[model samples]
Target: MAVAPPTTSQNPLQLELQALKAQHPQYHVVIWATYGGSASLLPGARWIRRDTLSISTNRRNSWNFTYGTHLYDYYVIIEGKFEYHNKRMKAADYSSFVASTAGFDFGTKQSVMRPKPEFRADSWMKHLSDDLLRHGPLVLDKQLDDVLDDVKDFLEDNDREVVMVMLSFSSASAVYEAGKPWSEGYRIKYDEVPDHFNREFKKDMKKDKDLYTGKKWPRLGEVRGKVVICRGWDVDAEQDQWGLHCRLPKWEAAHGFTSNIKPSALAAHRWNELVGDFGKQDAPKSIVLAACLHHDPADEESWIPPLQTAPILQRKAEEHIRKSTKKTKHLWIYGDEMKKKTNMAIAKLNFLGSDDVDFTRPPPMTVKSAPVLLVATH
Candidate 1:
């Protein structure tokens, strides 16, 4: 008889769930169904018991249980094979039920689901190692290549010329270096052309040869498109490793622009300048593609409000392209802090269509009269 592969009694996922519950006693941990092997391993976990309870009843009872008390601040939903009316309940249904019971408005709370680990710990670690290796510069290069390929296809399909502009901070030196090898692409210095409209400088740029290939830079009128990379001005690459230390005053001064001039205006001005330099009468319908980082400062000392430049640039580009054959698109990659800052900045703009879309506003505060610990098990 063939022997089956040996299996361990301990499940990695169960251990994670147990640790999560232990670390956060304030959260209400709910397992949707009782069928999963790991569900019973979680201590102090609540069972939905969908076989015996309806979602509406659960909602009503949960509210009644905590109506006059403060039971849990948040709900952490765990997945299991749940069924209702002989139909399998989806993970989304569990999330929706929890959201409704917790009185969480749509999009207020993000789901906290962990990725399923491999059966063996070693296998899981190897998978994680591979994932880490695939990220960073390699992944960024692939992403840029994909975007450029798509843009090229679009240009061919539409018979249009485009100018792809990439804006990054001095901190993203790796990304800047990775993009340096693209054909007809060049990095622009902060003070190279103080006056972009200067005829002499424009003429000089047309005659400039690539230091590597000895090929003259493509004039906007001669080619389908060109890539221009712009780095944050006056930011020390050595000091600001992540481009988080950029000061607004220094940035404005570097560009010789007045204080408080929006970064979006500067970006638009650059785009127009590029268009004017390369634009031909026959190719009036030009496309602009911008990619930039959205940085949110970690402290007051390092705060850079101009990091919220992406959305304003988008709005300005949209307005400029309206009723014209020109097209514009932008991509902003941000982290958790960046997301919060950008949302707050956008909220302050007050240009959003609906009051319901307030991102910076917090939910109404309530008083906690009593504490409740309601833990159910299979």
Candidate 2:
């Protein structure tokens, strides 16, 4: 299921790498690239050996990159369905990193209340420091800012503005933000994130919603001079802190999308209108995005193209294209799910898989996308 990395570099694998090189002529130059996800079909999809593609969460291999080290000019930390392997290192080096495992008995001692409990009224959410909890978009402000600082030191690029694109905004696991962008991981987390917080987030949905709203990207070609911070979901689908580069398609709460507004879906629906009215419309200066993946719904509360979600995705894409201006705005999506989704929303998803890709490991094999964001215990 790991695609075997191609022992001898076969036909498709070679071709794929070559094509990526053509599109992204800057390979070794990519200083901070966090790898993960299945975007083999995307036209411009290219990944730098960008920091070891930290697979410790996917497996138990030795540490790959340096702790507290800065090698590139940019630092992009991806937080998704991954758990880093840092137990062996001194706390100082890996002190702020994270690695998480999914599916549990709830009553277990160690994990029973490790994170979710700390955030839920029935158990957690009260004691944990919002400094690192990532329960919503605002919660990420600090942590994201810190990471940005690190990137700044590395690239000699100091830009304050932060941009984020969530795939599972309204997703429950997405409560960490608000499931704005849809993902494939939250579907399996049917119960991890709490449901109560969702209502609270929905109140702010009319603003800049998360992954679950079923909207697309907003129009941002207007600002031709601002320094932008692009944010998208981690595509690895691994549960870790540095995995924030791409969006994962999973279910909710702390472990998935952290928002309540799925604005991406809306963008997807209005794609046509947006493109047509581009120069005539008033949009944001820049935009960051999280193009995550989610479950293939089969029932009501989540079924048939997952209702409004599809429309949102389309709109977001248009918004992304609109914001490509070189000024304060740029476009970034964590996972390449769109490359595949662009062709077919449904395809051979769960054929050959592993905990490397499937963190929750459900029956159908695919992870859930985004769910309504709810408080862990509220």
Candidate 3:
């Protein structure tokens, strides 16, 4: 079990923005990914959940962000979960195909000799590429479509210009790159990227014939009101390539923290350790951090206290920049505590709106005080 200490700090959101304004003094766009707590706290940014803008709020939305196209036109895609078959085929069929090609499936089902009319085995790359395309971005295309559409809707709603010109990287991008292909028995794709499959997918999508001719998939600069999807690896050949940032979180992953430590205390400590990495030349101009203040009440493993998340993330961000001797400027965004509280309260009320509702009182909610620091860093 982990414990956390307290720290006093002013409003993290305000402090972060003031620092950005003072440091950049020019237009900047941030592409970030974090949990809801941090998303809601972005100062001038708008918080649009993946569903609120793309589909019905009833569906789970993964991506959330504030529109900053006025400053930057690029879409720095970040961030996860659950599982579905990418081949969209039944297990038996995939097993049969694999057995016919690999001599056995899971080393159990042997490939029997075919009947009189036999055939040559398909190229190994053929089978491999098929599986990769099906399991990779192809399966994710629809969900990503929803995200892109939501961004389009925001642009339309606000009448902002759309363009994706550049790509940048942070340590988070490295985490994503670290995701190797999911292969079980032979360990075929461990820590390896199937470049051939990715290139082939891109080539097929770019074609002007058949199913590719008319699709919602945003092609590079092909349509109006659509933004290009840029990968961090594509930004610069030498430095911006995919890899982990120097600062690794003490926790398992940055997605959610579940220890008994108070949210603020945990965030402050993590920031203290990670702030130095902000000075890296390839550090993101804008960071999308999972708001520490917003924890899933339903997530029993997560031990976040009310309001501590936002302040903790904010404090850590400020400290990251101030302590760094490198002359660099950036902004960090996380969730808003008050907004989360309002939303959480409303959700509770909605749960009881039904006549069949047996529950009366809402779930437990609590708040704790954290030490604040009044000194300014210039």
Q: TM-score: which candidate is best?
A: 3
Superposed model 2: Cα runs more than 4 Å off = 1-19, 23-142, 157-277, 281-336, 340-378
Residue 367 in model 3: lDDT: 15
- lDDT of candidate model 3 versus the reference: 0.29
Q: What is the TM-score of each candidate against the true structure?
A: 0.21, 0.25, 0.33
For residues 204-304, write the lDDT of model 1, one tens digit per residue. Answer: 43453311111222233343333222222333434222211212211211213333545565556545543331223321122222222212111122112
- The TM-score-based order of candidates, best leading, equals 3, 2, 1
lDDT of each: 0.27, 0.25, 0.29
RMSD of 3: 20.0
Instruction: Give residue 314's error in model 2 in angstroms.
Output: 6.5
Q: List the residue pairs that clash in candidate 1.
A: none
Per-residue lDDT of model 3, residues 247-295, tens digit only? 2122222234333557656656556555554554544333323233212
Q: Is candidate 1 or candidate 3 better by TM-score?
A: 3
The Cα RMSD in angstroms, rounded to one decimal, for candidate 2 relative to the true structure is 19.8
Report the Cα lDDT for residue 138, model 1.
16
